[model samples]
Target: MQLIEQNYARMRETATRDLTAAYLDRAMAELRGELTPRKPEEKALTWYDPDQTVGFWARRMSLEAVAHRVDAELAAGEPVMPIPADLAVDGIDEILVTFLAFASRQWPEDFGDGLAGADGRAVSISVGTDRRLVRPAASGVEVSRDDSTAEASISGAPQDVLLWLWGRGDGAGLTFDGDPELVKRLRYLLKEATQ
Candidate 1:
């Protein structure tokens, strides 16, 4: 959080906003230089873990860039740009499986209650041709393709679903059917996972 605090302080400085831009420019260039030569599987340090891999951090940074781009657009009162389906799909998979499903060790305090709220309740998420079911499991919530018993569903374009998961959008563009409480619980869990 130290780096984030420094960045925020720089942005809030009363001297000149151009200084903030210059600092960000230098920081981005430095980050690119550091990461450009790293192999995907190479061990690396990240905010989330002391020793993850280059690929993990790289993927996360790429998604953060997309999310921040949307943030900037919305802040500027500009229409949100289109995200490539492949990137959106990959983002959805990474956030759900990598961060939420398989990584119980990183789960937040409310994970158990959240999982219980979703028990016997599966929400099918359809992104383009990709389909997944989110349901309770031994560890937190598990996302799978077993949609045969799905009692709820959220279907939308790839970008929409990805943005929804990131809390970038209100999901107005997405179609949600079945139990609202299940969806609310899913949103709560998402807030826990992302924030």
Candidate 2:
């Protein structure tokens, strides 16, 4: 806990209002430098990046920055702005694709038990007009853009869906279709994977 406290303190100290622009510029430069050496077709190993590619990291980081900006604003008691629908869609995709996949790999035992009830069952997720169908795979989950008749479906606006998927929202505004018990089970699995 001491190490965590020290790191938290260090972050607090460095979190200055005046240096925000400079910090962002420097961070972008570093990220660009890291991406510059990669071939167009190459897939890089990334812990939290989506799709194992530089492009995915760039997109994911952009969304992350916007989310963190909301967090900072909320901390300062300012009104929050909505994230763009497209960006929120991408954020949801990153969680479903990159984050969950990495989590399953890191903690296989947790997922094996967590996802068992929902295994081989397809769950369709809809955010506005965007949609994805996902089913359990041996490794984690597999996603496809095409719609299918799923065992359960969750539908909501992009922002609400993104917030719900990230555990920031309670899914109160989302609609659940098909079997209620199956939806509950899938929600549990998603929460466990994210945690």
Candidate 3:
């Protein structure tokens, strides 16, 4: 758990730092007339205000990058790198617990209730410590957990699973079993993130 947490933290920090530097470079270019700033009325805008802090964006980007890195490593058929269990727990807590909790709360009330009968469905996540429970939302999508005792299991190298959770489709190297519908729904959630 500790190793997962440490790696996650390191990945997050590295991603944030790299992205910040890139943003800074672009902003500097705009200031020097090498690039043009978007008009205030532009319908599409990418850059944030230079004076405004972008911690939220940084965190999101960090997680996305780290998740993909895990995927890439796994796809290469390399040995699964172990992360601190605590860090893995923290990543799950932030992305699944905290972030997804907010998403569930903020989701439009009219949004069609997720998969039918998904509420009582059991899921187990075993990236580090084991977690087991019914799907959090009516939405069918969910993270994978330990299958040794789970009714339906989704197992893979941590990185592949993380990438799949984050919605990366290139998970040919990963393994999954049972509840194909649930897996599809989970994949959909990841796809939504890309949009």
Candidate 4:
């Protein structure tokens, strides 16, 4: 995927506003024409997985765009628009289920080092008390979305939780209870997974 490498390199190289905007416009136009018509079940290529579905890429791209928009807003000292609760929830789910759950796929070498100490206890993250996302913080991360027990719980509003999970927002509106060790492990996993 030379284009992927090229795109990443281009992102690191600063360009004029016109050039950047033009490139983005062309990319978006191509995406609309090519990817928009693809079925959700259709096979797609991802940075981490080539055997992914169009639906996976679609959800991932949407969440990535939102995360980048937040980064732009923060970089420019501009106010970020409120993310809808549903989108925020979905973004949280995506990060937890795909990114953290598949941590080995991204950085297998450094991943285990980041997760040195693990007791195999789970952390239950709550999105307004309705969603119970339990993920065990271990060398091999896994998320179980069900009414499960965990050693720790982090509860917050959907958007706040999503932003905090992404390191875009402080955990001011969030509350943590139960085992601190579990929370620490999970937070470290989240940071490593997102990074």
Candidate 5:
């Protein structure tokens, strides 16, 4: 579904405002009473149940709001605020362990080559208190936190890093001190998938 695109220049200006309402309206319209069985053994899911519906929409709206707010902050040339540690951790868990895991199984090619191979390695990704280790089953891409001992470190404001991950920022002012190829590949994959 097409989500509303806001052109807010800064999230600091909008943080107190509620963006969830607009997302809820859209989600309700799109998923109303829809019950598409995801697996043969399980029953279909629907929005008719208040609890189920609210839970689903809450996650969706939260991510949507957080992502856009990050964008707004970036556009305004301000440091991106730390997504509350709890929220960030939950989001990372759901996206990597739940959403992307399923997507990878269903559409392996989307994750790239090493993700489908046996020698593939997992990389640990952490943002603030949020952390996860994901390996491409066939792809050889490896992501890990830079060892504090590295002579040089790749660094940027956390917000820029988050925006880069979300495929939103230009990455112009970001720093890269490690494997340039890996960084390039990561950026390429994000861009490719979003496109």
Candidate 6:
């Protein structure tokens, strides 16, 4: 951790915004090269499937870059721009489908209580017209689009939902309906899984 911090400090000392932009462009170009020659069976550690690898990184990095930009803007005492609806929706999908889904499966014992709630209990997240229901399943976690009733529901714009899920912003403008305890449990589960 100390070495990582030192490296970051050194980079910060030498990096200007223009230099960073140039570096990012070069890095992205190189990353694009990574996909060009690699076969599907080539080993890679990705959160999503091989067929969806490029799409997954594009969505993941878009959200990560925007979130990091927000951090920079905050440090500079500037207001942050909102994320686009499409990107934010993809971000939500990434969290629920990849991050949390894999994490719960990888650490079933830790997530057992949080995911395996009472029978018929589930939490729903709605961003505009997009709705996803998450419930504990025999396999680990089950996520699907469902308009049915749920034990708890959170509704907001896609950007707000993404930010709230990532613990970046307070959920002041969001609406939470139904069981508060369940919502809190869901929040805890998200944080734990992400960490």
> What's the TM for model 2?
0.68
RMSD of each: 5.7, 7.4, 10.3, 5.8, 8.6, 6.8
lDDT of candidate 3 over 1-195, digit per residue (tens): 223234344433344457754754564344334213433334432233321233333334445445654654456554445543444454554455433434444552323444443553545544534453325456433444434344455555554555455565366656666676666654543344333
Computed on alpha carbons, the lDDT of every model, listed in order, comes to: 0.72, 0.67, 0.46, 0.70, 0.48, 0.69
Please, what is the TM-score per model? Answer: 0.81, 0.68, 0.48, 0.80, 0.50, 0.73
For this target, which candidate reaches the highest lDDT against the unseen true structure? 1
73-149, model 1: which lDDT tens digit per residue? 67756677687788899989877777676554465464656665455578888987799888855457778876476
What's model 5's overall lDDT?
0.48
- List candidate 5 segments past 4 Å from native: 1-53, 111-118, 127-130, 139-164, 168-195
The deviation in Å at residue 109 for candidate 3 is: 4.7
Give the per-residue lDDT digits (tens) of candidate 4, residues 1-195. Answer: 222233323332333377776776676567556656888789877665634788776676667767766675676566766777878889888788777776544565556564656646778888875665555534576677678677788889898889988888878889998998787777777787777
* Residue pairs of candidate 1 with colliding backbone atoms: none
Global Cα lDDT for candidate 4: 0.70
Q: Which portions of model 3 miss their true places by more than 4 Å?
A: 1-61, 64-89, 108-117, 132-150, 190-195
Candidate 3 CA-lDDT value: 0.46
Candidate 5's TM-score reads 0.50
Ranking by lDDT: 1, 4, 6, 2, 5, 3
Q: For candidate 1, report its TM-score.
A: 0.81
Q: For candidate 6, lDDT tens digit of each residue in 1-195?
A: 222223233334344588885775676567557655765455656655533545445445556666666566556666656666877898898788776766677676766476666344688999878999987554566678977779899999898898888877799889999988867877877887666
Q: Itemize residue pairs with steric clashes in candidate 4.
A: none
List ranges where model 2 is wrong by over 4 Å.
1-45, 48-52, 74-77, 101-107, 110-112, 137-139
lDDT of 5 by residue, 1-195 (tens): 122122222333644445644554555455533323222234334332323444555455556667777766666677766665456555555444444444555555766652533333334455544444444444333333343232222345455555555677676656656545445544554443344
Local lDDT at 137 for model 5: 46
